[model samples]
Target: MFYDVFVFLVIILTLLILSGLVSASEVSLFSLPSETLERFSKSKIRTHKLIAKILEHPQRLLITILISNNFINVGIALLSTLSALRLSYAININPEYAVSISIIVVTVLVLLF
Candidate 1:
């Protein structure tokens, strides 16, 4: 039970970090000025050209980022719930209380970090 909970925590933390990185990328990429993009498009560097090419279809990038964020958030929620259930059963406590606590705690955590 302890190992299962630890694994769940590790996964949840990773997913949270991934979600944050994805969100940061969305902000940073979309916030770039037109001049910067233009420079990137004309740059000799392969990486810059690739970035410009990918950014050419802003709609697709936005959709992809949004989908990734959604999946990460859902995974965190699912793991939290499962861990909470495991905890409730292990301690012979009311499952609803454990689930409710876990939900509140996880939500706060996701919001805070």
Candidate 2:
């Protein structure tokens, strides 16, 4: 039981980090200057070409990021809820109250970092 909870917490943390990275990447991509994008488009590097392709349709990229970020956030919320449930069970606390507390704490943590 302890090990399961530990693993779940680790997964939740990993999801949070991935969510942050995706959010940051979206901002970084949108903030790139047109000149930089043009230069990247002309480059022979495979990664540069991929980035250029993604940037060609900024709206599509934005939509994709938003969708992915939503999924990640949901995953984080679900995992945290489960963690709270497990903790509350172990401590003989009410699961209903734990749910609200978990969501608030997770939201604050995500926003803080």
Q: Candidates' lDDT values, in order?
A: 0.92, 0.90
For residue 41, model 1's alpha carbon misses the true position, in angstroms, by: 0.3
- Alpha-carbon runs more than 4 Å astray in model 2: none
For candidate 1, report its TM-score. Answer: 0.93
Q: Could you tell me which 10 consecutive residues in candidate 2 have the lowest summed lDDT?
A: 104-113
Model 1 lowest lDDT segment of ten: 104-113
- C-alpha TM-score for every candidate: 0.93, 0.92
TM-score computed on alpha carbons, candidate 2: 0.92
Cα lDDT of model 1 by residue, 1-113, tens digit: 97998899999999999988999999989998999999999999998898899899999999999999888988999999999999899989999999999999989977764
Best by TM-score: 1
